[model samples]
Target: MAQLRSVPSRSGRGRTLLAATGLVLVAAFAQAPSTALAAGGPVPAAPAADGPQLSYVVNAVPGAVETRAVARAVRAAGGSVVVAYERIGVTVAHSGAPGFAEAMRAVPGVQSAGATRTAPLRASGTTDIGRPQKVDLKQALGQARQVERARGGTAAGGEPLEPLQWDISAIRADRAAKVDDGSRRVTVAVIDTGVDDTHPDLKANFSARQSASCVGGRADTSPGAWRPWDPASDYHGTHVAGTIAAARNGVGVAGVAPGVKVAALKVSEPGTSMFYAESVVCAFVFAADHGVAVTNNSYYVDPWLFNCRGDAGQRAILDAVGRAARYAERRGVVNVAAAGNSAMDLAAPKLKDTSSPDDSTPVSRTVDPATCWDVPTQLPGTVTVAATGAKGLRSYYSNYGLGRIDVAAPGGDSTQVPDLPAKNGNVLSTMPGGEYAYLAGTSMATPHVAGVVALLRSAHPGASPQEIQWLLKLEADNPGCPASDATCTGTRHVNSHYGYGLVDALDAVRR
Candidate 1:
């Protein structure tokens, strides 16, 4: 079965927590009007010293003077400043000190402070990471050969797997490429586990200059810093990159916007594959500073399935990431994130979140939709995406809501099979070690939209992020809510399952 987008319903302590859904990097966000802690409140209970050392982000007032003062306050509050991002006013710190977050928040110039994860730093790698189903190219190749014979024989010279890429045709990406394959100036950052630029399809268009490793909340621009930390299971970024811009070299599958370049932002924890606030914050700032046009976030911030507003710590995580995303948008970068794989209605009256504090024990709780949100995804100015199958229907595992999903695209489905040459329902793309695989999820669907967004960027280089997003929504081709399912609301043009509608790459270029 196709894996759902980030974080499959929280599993037992030792199972594969996030295969494709490790898009599970999801950061549950609560959309409250205010995240302010009680002013002049008494000190809260101290955290256990021996528990687990965690990373934290102390929001500062973005300036040299304010950041310096905040850094000193961090140390005084029993936290060590990891890196102070003056431009965005985010100071990353580490602390095992009891009441570190509460102490930091009390300091002047600190907007918010929260632990990045429930697990101790780097302790996440202890969990087993699962790999995706590999593509059966041998059988696929043989079948393509038979099709060639039916058309009079002996076809050659194309990505061997292109025959199975019904996804390209599904969104008219194939047709768009003929008119305009995209521009080399445009770059989309795959902010996920890590991207294998060494793959033949990706190397040609990989942008190393703008890539970095923000794993520990600090930006590391060392050589190949953007490459996967866990090659065994870090195939997610490479597959996603392939879908956005795998290059049309005819050696492998072509991407949605093949001429555009793709960059890597390795934010996943080395061993655990966890995505936390600090790393995510670093990615947005780095992308903004490095001139990234679009960022595809397939994962969510880990440790919490939903960061409720009532909780000061989760609120801080949401605030820090939201600041970074808005900053990137201000700097001309468009941010796109997955809508999650939980299959819950994000805009429902209330939600049952059972996977919170995922690094430790999970507790189930009912949350009001008016407050809790899917961070970065539900965060303001971020384009939230939903998954569709080969049949253009919402993927069974995709999360949806009347106002949550901004658009939909083929994320692939085992049951919604397409009738094209390739009979498989899963998405096909490049993998690490010069291989390819078939995976699915809103994680998979996100890149298809990112690719089209890149095309819009290439076509209208002078347009702002907001302008591009407007065009993206205006050009969508909505597939009305399923007749059998009453959950999908809104009109044919804008509905919960598809938002504005299925993305149209052809319109992105020609319109």
Candidate 2:
């Protein structure tokens, strides 16, 4: 069966968390069973969400004029508006009333309406992580520094862990940094779990003005609103932020686009850590409206692993997120998303999905890949990224497809260890509490590409989103498919396993 594939990465041989579907948590997940076609059948129709207090996304035409009409209809349908994102035609609502979605769907300008989750609302707890070690990489990095320090030459006056960050050299970001470290004018939004901007490596480049928490389908701009809900467990966003733009401040580690600014638009729910539809919609709209130049989405819009269009509720969630992504692109925000960590052929026909409604007990259902889509990443205009290892081959857990993947980058692989200090093959980056850790997933790969995109945006300030994406594909270094794998297909330049090939940060800046 197609189970939830959240492969979490840890600190010091620990795991990194990938929330919802296509994620991390310190384990390998296999693809659907071989009997998928034989056992899978059409999914049963689900009743309208009229039983419990659930969040709903009511999409209208992108304009206040049309949004006003839908808001009025939402109230009449016994629902209150959580937030109305007129910029992207998405209005979030909370309603337990019978047929709330059905009533809103009947409204004149409404395009789509559906409940976001099966689990009812509840407060999740946050953990108090132990105090961070005193900031001193000299003693902590003892011997590994002396060994790999010679191999990993200093770039932008490199950080202490630069010698251990084999992921950086895997994509040639170290060389790219010399040409251009990116511009502070551009900001890449880490649209995932909250980020710990207070981390030493991230604070210098963290833009508080552009950061906000879009947790409950609403944007909260309070102080540290963008910080992680639980630093110990929710360090996913912080680790991701570190890779994208953790600053080249000779402290711990350097990010791919060290000069670029990073903003956190957290969408994951506190306790559940699920990336719901309404929060995702808010993130896209927020990134677009803000001065963000790029957005990195490491997780799929959840509950559903692959949301099928046949289901009315799933279709609405897909449409709402699609609109938000489209809106961001139109406003010059090029979005980059991870191509999942399930190791499934996204281009192939999918049969059984056993991960829908992940917040509650899930039931198996038949799905068509042609109609069922992975949000943000598979959506048109978004960059779908696959993961590569230090050896320059596809990461064992990354999802790939002939036409589905846009590019590849080093996410990391425990099996493909290089002669580096970290010893753990996972990508090294800043964790919470001013510390550093190693994690691997397509979740880690997306940031490398986003960082390169940030460099592109910096070098070509006049380029449009489409232009940046085009340059990204053209600049990649394709290694083609590995010989041992016969399941892979496509040519060297554009294959299922590597897409446009490994992302070249060095080329992103100079070209």
Best by lDDT: 1
Tens-digit lDDT string for candidate 1 (127-203): 32223667666776776566666657633344566667877878888888888889999999988878899999999
**Model 1 superposed RMSD (Cα):** 6.6
Q: Candidate 2 residues 26-57, lDDT tens each? A: 11111111001112321122333456777788
Model 2: weakest 10-residue lDDT segment is 29-38
How high is the CA lDDT of each candidate model? 0.75, 0.75
Clash total of candidate 1? 17
TM-score of 1: 0.89
Show model 1 residue runs off by greater than 4 Å. 1-51, 122-131, 147-158, 420-422
Q: List where candidate 2 sits over 4 angstroms from the true fold.
A: 1-50, 122-140, 149-156
